[model samples]
Structure formats: C-alpha cells, structure tokens
Target: MASTSTSATSKDSPEPSPDVRVWLGNRQAVEEVTDHERLAAMTDTELAQQGEPKVRRAIPMKKACTFLNIPGGTPLLEGVGTVVKAWPHMSDASAPAWVASTSGAYASLLAEHFGGVEVREPEDPDVMHGPYTTDTAAVAGETKGKG
Candidate 1:
C-alpha cells in the first residue's frame, strides 16, 4: 500500500545529491510535478530513483513568506480598499507575485493571472506527502529547481 512520511530540514546549507541543484522560484515547495519536459527523458525506473536533490535549510517555506508582500494593515477583500492593501506594495502593481502549487496548468494559470509570474515555493519529500517511491514515481517527476 502507498504510505506517507515527513522529516525536518537541517539548519545547515543544502547538501549535494546526484540530481541537479538549484532553487525553485516559488518560496509549499511543489508536490507531484510529474510533468517537467526534462524529466520526461528519463526512463521510468530512472525517474523514480531520481528523487529531488537532498537539501537543508533552517527556515521553512511558510516562514519565508511571513514578511513577504504583507500589507501594513488588514487586507481588504474587494473594491478600492483592495487597491490600498494589496501585496508586494499596493502602490506597485508591477511589484510581482509568486504562485506555489504543484507544477502544472493550475500553477501556470495562476502565474498567467499575475502576468505569467511563476512558482515561489519549495517541497520537502519527507514532509509534503512524499519521498515518492520508485514505483509511485515510475512515470512522473519533472519540476525544476529546489524540490
């Protein structure tokens, strides 16, 4: 049967793994990306075994966003009040925003809504419902940057 697990990221810097090493744009790390063009090239078994590069960072993704784009006062749902309390600075519509979901059309749409912004989150296989097994990942795993 399929199972799930979680683990804590070490406070130290990211450690190296066989997979490519870099940071993703979104600040949830994504889960079940399973469609990146690059990963498509890998054989089923290869892709399954090729888990994300192991990483370590003291701060969690949510904490990274605690101060980001936060409004000075309570946020308004709609109307001109929204104009005054928006994120990334209410005065700058061009300031920028980042979406954080599994890589796919939903994420794409969210980015497009923000003028094709992009993902700003990261995923921890240990925590975010994964550490996907070779069998479970036989055909997916294509997100880029940090996983």
Candidate 2:
C-alpha cells in the first residue's frame, strides 16, 4: 500500500514554485528607465551631434564705453567694476533721467537715445534701470501733462 506523509520544510528549503504566467506577465509589465547619470555619461561631442538639449542663443554684450561717449581708443577695463551713472530710457533728449551703475555711461546713452528710464542695480550697479512700471506711467503722464 502506498502511503502519503506531510512534513514541515527546513529553514533553508527552496521556496514554492512560481507561476510562469504571472512571471511572464510581470516581465511584460516591467518598464525601462533612463536617468540623469546615463544622460551625463554622454560625451559633449555626442551631445552636440545628437542635439539632445537645446542650445541658448547668446545676447550681444552691452558696451558701456560706447554709451559713455568714450572714444574707442580709450582703455577703460577699469570701469567694468565701477558704478557709472546712466539713464537708458529717457524720452526727452535734453532732460534725460539718470541712475547709478557700473555701466553708467551706457545706461545714460540709452536714456538719451531710447528714453526708457534710469536703472540702478545696487548689487550689480552696471545694470540698466528705470523702465520701471511706475516710472513708465509717471513719465508718460508727465509728457501728457506737459502737453
């Protein structure tokens, strides 16, 4: 006579059999992911060739000397860090507004030519200022009020 016995499995015993259908289903559901490390590993030449990321268009450097009415022959590298007063957007040519900046001369020129407003960048004083929202309204109002 054949006899059947049930015994407890050992701690090191193999796990029960897995369902092939579930395993296959899971395999099909698994998704592949590419991350930053994989992206960074790519070479610059490869990146440029592949055109993965968009390249930003560069803006032309604003020249302070030209705005300052300085001659081209004058050596003014020292002025890069110095605060120069400028009014980049003053509509009135004779009565142009003014502000302080590293590129004051340029700002002033812009004011005389374009008539925007005075800009003062205390942190980076070379920046153009004024064209401020309130300033625009005030300036336009002033112009209209005068007329």
Candidate 3:
C-alpha cells in the first residue's frame, strides 16, 4: 500500500476576503461607494500617496452643532451662510481638523482656535426666524374669565 500526504502552499489559494464598502462625502451627502474607479476618482493626492489610504467625510450640520454646543437651527448670514470650513487644530497636536459653519451665530464654535472675526448679518434681516413670541396673554385672559 502506498501512503500519500498533502500540504497546503501558496499554490493552494485561500478564500478571498469580502470587498469593503467605502463611504465618501462631498457638500451634499454621504454615500457608500464600491467601485475602485469611482474611489480613485474621489481620492485626492494626499490620500492616494498613503500605503493604507483613509477618507474623512464631512459631518452633518446638526451633529457639528451638537458637538460644539450650538443651536442646530441657527440661521447663517447670507453670502457667508451654509459654508463649512475645516482646518487643522493648531493648539492640539493630536486633534483632528475642526469643522464649523461660516455663520456668525456659530462664531463662538471656532473662537478658541481662530481669532473672533466679525461676520456680516444676512442682507435680508427678515430671512431669519424672529425671536419666540407666543399668545400667553390670550391664555391668561381665558383662564381669568373662566375663573
């Protein structure tokens, strides 16, 4: 009787790993991308040069506002409104880039790192939501009249 032994080698290929779905973002939205060509196109020079490339997606306004302890619904000044600025944290060596809107309402968000600069108010003053005002007088009158 002849005895045969088998050994696994490079020639015996292992099971392929699953393709990873990469997330990318621009000004509009976050999206999962699978195509290599699309990913390559989305990648910048800094990201492309790395051995293990990583992408940083922009965070949503609500999340950023929450993180910075600012009101989410704060209206931005026109022309300066809706623009998000991201820059490296100069004070902290380990910190990631800071992101904030260009609106004056959120100026405090970046005050520590950047010198407080005066941001212009919206051209149309009426564009912003007015301060909260309710018909409390009507409720008081109804209660008093009933009593």
Give the per-residue lDDT digits (tens) of candidate 2, residues 1-147: 111111223467565321110000000111122345656778989877874532222123222211222222222332211112221122212322333323344334434443455544334333233122111111111211111
By TM-score, highest first, what's the ranking? 1, 3, 2
Off by over 4 Å in 2: 1-101, 122-147
After superposition, the stretches of candidate 1 with alpha carbons farther than 4 Å from their true spots are 1-97, 124-147
Query: The CA-based lDDT of model 2 is what?
Result: 0.27
TM-score of 1: 0.22
Candidate whose lDDT is highest: 1
Lowest summed lDDT window (length 10), candidate 3: 138-147
Q: Clash number for every model?
A: 11, 22, 0
**Using Cα atoms with residue i matched to residue i, what is each candidate's TM-score against the true structure?**
0.22, 0.18, 0.18
Scanning candidate 1 in windows of ten residues, the lowest lDDT window is 134-143
Candidate 1 at 85: error in angstroms?
A: 11
Cα lDDT of model 3 by residue, 1-147, tens digit: 111111212345564322111010112222122345545665576456743333333334321111111122222222112122212111112221233332433443333333443322323222123121111111111211010
Residue 31 lDDT in model 3? 18
All models: lDDT? 0.29, 0.27, 0.24
lDDT of 1 by residue, 23-132 (tens): 11323222233345556566878868985333222323432221111121221122112222222221123423444433233334445556766544336433233222
Clash list (residue pairs), candidate 3? none
Q: After superposition, how far is residue 111 of candidate 3 from its true place, in Å?
A: 3.9
